[model samples]
Target: MSIRKVVFPVAGLGTRFLPATKVIPKEMLPVVDKPLMQYAVEEALAAGITDFIFITARGKGVIEDHFDKAYELETELARRGKDDMLERVTDFMPEGTTSIFIRQQEALGLGHAVLCARAAVGNEPFAVVLPDDLIAGNGRNVMQQMVDVYDRQQGSVVAVERVPKDQTDRYGIVETGELQERVAPLTSIVEKPKPAAAPSNLAVVGRYILTPRIFELLQNTRTGAGNEIQLTDAISALLAEESIYSYEFDGTRYDCGNKLGYLQATLNYGIRHAEVGEAFREYLDGWNNSRDS
Candidate 1:
């Protein structure tokens, strides 16, 4: 069966973004005109995911409202004869697609947040996407690549990218055993290992195609780094009984969880945006010239 379900873990405190994130969820932060969470949802839809499950915490109700039907806004736009704006809200959600919101209830780690959606996911393979990691692909969307990998392998697949050896400790590093086309059969995964102990520079990123069994493994997993239950640790345990592959998906991923990555994403997407591209590029050129002088 095709992977039809996806879990979005949006319960993070956004501590990195301090005062702004105190009220606004970092996922709601925009890259140009689209928010990170909207981009993630659109990517999943492109991958043919039928169910959208959002595991959120307190102060995240805005995300639910954002995805929900805005009847009042649409009606007002129609009354004002703004068909373009009306169509935008009317078409915000895909036809025949539905969304489910689950409460995480507590400030837990990624693993716990994922497990909160166990009921919504049921007994099927699903994709897990972190909205903070806004990945844009050239030919196909990021989740589409993972879905394609899942079709052939029928096992779990993760989107990975090579990082510098010294930076390996910043992410969950994996060792490649053998190649299954573009997908690498993972031999082992070490969470935040030091540079000297890192097996490889391949760092696991946000996108993941996981089997239902992950819920079981996550349930038994003990807290690791930062005293929070780490999803990388749970996946490691699943490796003994099952096969999990990592594929370096074709994409330029923006780490929008922090300030720098967010700004980078804004600049990158801004220059490519059809409405603002020309003006934005001109502005950038002028700013660069001034800085040089």
Candidate 2:
């Protein structure tokens, strides 16, 4: 079946961002001119997803508003004849695409956040994109690449990338069976294993194309690491029942949830922007030369 719907768990308090995130959501933070969440949304759209299920919290109304029509801004832009800016703001949501917002009242774990979208997701296979992981790639989007694997295998697939052995404990590390060019048949997954205990360096990223059976697994999933319901636990159960493969997504992922990663993403994207790329390149060159002198 074609994967038409996607779930976005945006309910986290984003405490990492502190004072600024106390009012605004970290997902709303801009990379260059676009917000982080928009990158995920655009990625999903590029991957053929037409329906969006946003599991949001209290202070995340701005997210919904961001994708909606900004009438006042549009009118002002019209008055000033800023047609370019007008198009940019008004083109947030594409026609025929459906967006549904569900409230996740608690700051539960990732598994619980996904379960909150069960009703909207129904029994069909759906994609889950974590906005915190902003991926940069050419051609196919990460989700699209996973969907291609799902199309061939007809099972669940998650995006994985090779992490340093020492860093394996920081992520859900996957044990491999047979490796194709880009896809690896996953044998098992261990969440945050020690460096010596890690089966492989392939770590699961935030992008997932999950079957409906996962919702059931998550419902009965007991608290694991950090006493929070881990998505890895549910995925492990799914792996036991059926085929779950890992795809090494051809992309550069930025963990916008971390302060350093967020700043790096902003600087990287800013330096690549058509409007600022040349000037920013010169600025960096001058700074580097001065430091050397």
Candidate 3:
């Protein structure tokens, strides 16, 4: 009831990233100093989520290893008197947090990947975080903001942002009744509507706070675009049964699923990194001066 669990749908093959993603999972791709998945996990952790359900695939074993304790590495770092590096490695995963990985045998759609976590999710409301959508929040993270909305709404809440109307075809667009400032009650949701046909510019992002009932809806959802079951279709059905709201979360989201967005995230995070922030900024300024001259 307090939203203690979260589902991470990370099983997709990163074909967009081509050769780099051929071996490494896109979720494992680093932004600056940390992997994309680590940021998602840290965000959820900030929201007090203790149980994590990772829907994974065959090549995603490295992700599991990423979260697991690096005993040998830690020991070596300690032996070498690298306390700072050892702390960083040992602190990757905090104690008392549970991580469960479920294999998505086939590369289905996002909806299907979520359905795979039904057993692990059981009957509680859970959050679904897509690591590819690296959201940098202002003060409060996106998932935390949605959980607060769920507390008041007592239904489902999806994270939405005002995307360019022309890019409506790229994301699931939501139709809303009226705006309660940042939050709005959804009237309907259409997956990947064309620019001309899109209901509104507000498009659903990666963060979701869904009830367990969604698993049932996902089970009956037919494959839509890309010949795979669409989570938007399931959420559209749930709209008929209960109230679902969309929150225009206060955050900057990087669509790390594509090459441009990934590079942008790396540059943005790199410039602000604690260790290299000032130096990176200086390097950028020097590069710009050199290029201009």
For model 1, residues 154-212, the per-residue Cα lDDT tens digits are: 99998899998899888999998776667889899989999999998999999999999
* Tens digits of lDDT, candidate 2, 1-293: 98999999999999999998999998999998999999999999988999999999998999999998888989999999999999889876799899999999877788899999999999999999999999997678788888889999999998999988899888999988888978878899988999999988999989999999999999999989878789999999999899998998888998899999998898899899999988998999999999999
**TM-score of model 3 vs. true structure:** 0.98
> lDDT (CA) for every model shown?
0.90, 0.92, 0.94
TM-score: which candidate is best? 3
Give candidate 3 misplaced runs (Cα > 4 Å). Answer: none
Query: Count of backbone clashes for each model?
Result: 0, 0, 0
Error of 2 at 264 (Å): 1.7
Query: How high is the lDDT of residue 59 in model 2?
Result: 89
Q: Give the TM-scores of the predictions, in the order they appear.
A: 0.97, 0.97, 0.98
Model 2 regions lying over 4 Å from their true place: none
- RMSD to the true structure for each prediction, in A, is 1.1, 1.1, 0.9
Order of the predicted models by lDDT, top scorer first? 3, 2, 1
In terms of lDDT, model 2 sits at 0.92
Clashing pairs in 1: none
